[model samples]
Target: MSTRHILLGLLAMGPRHGYDLKHRHDERFPQARPLAFGQVYTTLQRLVRDGLAEVEETGSDGGPERTMYRSTDAGARELADWAGSVTPSAPFVANEIFAKVVVAILSGGDPAAYLAAQRASHMQRMRELTAVKSAKDADLTTVLSADYALTHLNADLRWMTTTADRLATLTAEVEST
Candidate 1:
């Protein structure tokens, strides 16, 4: 994920301190891995250094002083370009699961057993994500994120099933290599 671009986009909304940005990022992308505090500060600093953002203000209200950041005009332009651009879809399938399967076959390990375990794990995650998406209080953002994850997991599950069905052929090919 483009952490820098995301921070720039967030700053484009309004001035925000690191703490606020981090929390807002979490709220906006609940399915994403949570941003670390240090990561936020580091990314913010980089944005400032790159002239994509600047410190709008610094003040304290009976607490540690907070530096509020805002996106620069350049940052706004960059965010617009990034938002408008389309992400490439499956340009290459560099699948770790495929690699592991090949390795297991080559090493005389049980690829079928590994695939079974992986399928179980994927099913469990899909169940959890489904629950999150179907929760009574789930917001649009949360539901959308869960849906995105579920879609990917579903694809992975299909791939695993296909791979399992061809395991014997795959093993023969790997062994020949």
Candidate 2:
């Protein structure tokens, strides 16, 4: 999901500092898949540049106050528009990871090693996707996209497991002089 709507949503709630926004986003989106602070600030800057959000000084922090962001009327309107927009159906594109695995197998690189690394990565991804799926506040639009992506990861992990086992069996059978 693009950060545009996320920023707007944050501002829609009330004025918030950059850190506050990031924290709230993490709380909502889950830290396992948290948006980076750089990403949140960059999007916030873009929102300010777009006139969708404005930085305001807090009147009473009782110390050095930080810049807080509030959504403009236009921002609220934009958020509503975004919320009403239809979810577009898109085709999944091929990823380089699978290509790398195929190349490794064809090039006589040890399939066990390749699959070992791939399984580790895929298992981590699966955990993250599972966390996202279970999160209550996760936007379904984003969640469904993640779900589709995880389906591909699951398929690859299955292939890697099977291939690793088969290759290990074959490697064992070959007499090493």
> Among these predicted structures, which one has the highest TM-score?
1
List lDDT for all candidates, in order: 0.91, 0.80
When summed lDDT is taken over every stretch of 10 residues in candidate 2, the lowest stretch is: 26-35
Model 1 ranges with Cα > 4 A deviation: 168-177
Question: After superposition on all CA atoms, what RMSD does each candidate show versus the true structure?
Answer: 3.7, 6.4
TM-score for each candidate, following the candidate numbering: 0.82, 0.56
Q: How would you encode candidate 2's per-residue C-alpha lDDT over 1-177 as one tens digit per residue? A: 767798789878889988888888776665337878788878988998999999876554787656788999999999999999998866764667667767877898766787788789889988988887789877865587678879988888887788778777777788563
lDDT of 2 at 149: 78
Model 1 pairs in collision: none
